[model samples]
Target: MKNLLIAFLFNFLCLCVQGATLDFAFQLGEKQEPRLDKLLPDVARQMAFSRDSKKLIAKGMGGTVVKWDLQSRQKREISRIHAKRWFVYSIGANQLLVRDADDNITILSLGSGDETLLTNGQYESGSLSAEGTLAVLSKGDNEVEVWQLAKQGPKAVKTLQTSFPVRNGLTLSDNGQFIAAAEGTYGDGEGHRTAIEVWNTINEHPIKVFNTGEILGVWNVLFSPDATMLAVDTQKNAQSGIRIWEVETGRQLLMKSGFEAYWTRALAFSPTSDSLASGGEGGNLRIWDISEGESVIWETYPTGIQSLAFSPNGEYLAAALWDTTIQILHWGTSHER
Candidate 1:
């Protein structure tokens, strides 16, 4: 069985390499582009665009967050922190969330220029729900906390306690109803065994626990827009793959070989929940048909993808890569692929 799986993976990878081709619409931060270079340095930690895909938000290595407009090409330093290790965790349409070296969560409003200190607790990873109403943060040692965002102040809604020390890779459902977290250890014996746990945000209870066995470690987990499916990336002996699970039935629908050099870093579902896009490690972008349970289409670029976002109309797919460039791919072209 293992040999067959290996052979299948090898053949799939070859096909992916041959089929992969990137048709770039535009590049965000190229040399001689003063607008992008002047806003911040190229070594930014994270870059995200607003929900409308009209503006771009990038976190500088020096603890600064800048917002740039795509139409006017204007840039503004939205917020900055003095902490050496501070990094922007997530950026929303109206607000931006940043985490300091000390694990402090700060919320900043783009319109009013107001900032709110959400949490003082230390966390290894953090993410905002799709609706921007809730924030999930990992505190290490099998503990995670959820904060409710409000106009007045942010409140701690619940704490998710796990069985063992958990590493990063946290994802929240689109409707803000569920959270899927990767639970495992790091270093030496790392990647040995990782489990994915889905929890209900309202009651703060574990809805389902999917054990990935002893060979693979969970790299990323994503919940479908309708909260119907959970996509998980698992790594085994340096090879990585993805599995899709039906939330309601608790059935694993698909397990397909993914990028071999790097585990899947980002997984995003389309607005209609009919397709999914994932990118990681080898600068490979894969679009999968949920109904087919296989990767029918894939694309590869020059740089490794760090993050991905689908437009509200689901017409454009924006990918943030390691080369400090954002590539916007038309959804129509992908559908035709």
Candidate 2:
């Protein structure tokens, strides 16, 4: 009976290992390729698809923000607010948000071409919810505020503070309910520890924190479209690993590797939440199937990707390269892996 039980246990362990190592199946379509690249004016600082994925908001040279209609292929100049550098993103279909060099946040309306200043406080990095109703902004004081953007100006609904100052920016959920904040450094340097905190932005409370326990500083943190999973990456390209965590349970789902390259800090989740893409340092752009665990690489640019965005429909990907050009790749068609 002892020998029989040992055999059964061995078989069970083998099955578990097999299941864990299983690779996802991939199907890429033949003759389907990236459609074309669109070059834009000045240096592109930031690019983001409008909440509905219908339009794209970009901060071109001179701190000028432009909203491009994806379907019409036309450009509408939104704002040309001047500053040395700033953080700009689309608030929704009608408004655009720009945090200037002084850390002042301004809301721009595309239809009327009007600007509204948000005098909440001095903010460091920020993220907007999909609905444009909520915003999470990190301040220089190690405090994070969850703001209600849909109502009055920037009204602070919740505040989150960290023991350490933030290294990277913040990522908010679709409904503006959750926020992911990363703080720490990277590399083999001494005292290098990175931690990601997932907070309930709506309830104004803390959730789970992921302590990488490595000498790596996280560069980006993104939430899936459904907000069920979160992806974190560091500055170590070759040594960097994709840390995915379950939102509800606060449990890590998986760690994907082999993406190490030089300066791979830029990352964006597809609109479908089934894929991810990142670019930096090098002119190489890679697309990964989150579920299938495969990647399609593109090296069409002479420089690295400065910023990236997916169409609201997930049918296209727009990459602003360091070479001062924008490439809009046609996504959707699949091929055999």
Cα RMSD to the true fold for all candidates: 7.2, 11.8
lDDT of 1 by residue, 157-194 (tens): 77888766667467777577888788875457554667
Q: Please, what are the lDDT tens digits per residue for candidate 2 over residues 71-179? A: 6666766656642344545445356566766666777666687777776456667776765677777764567876777555667666777756777667788766678
TM-score of each: 0.79, 0.76
Backbone-clash count (model 2): 13
Give model 1's TM-score versus the native structure. 0.79
Task: Show the lowest summed lDDT stretch of 10 residues, model 1.
Answer: 31-40
lDDT of each: 0.66, 0.63
Displacement of residue 336 (Cα, Å) in model 1 is 11
Model 1, position 296: C-alpha lDDT score: 57
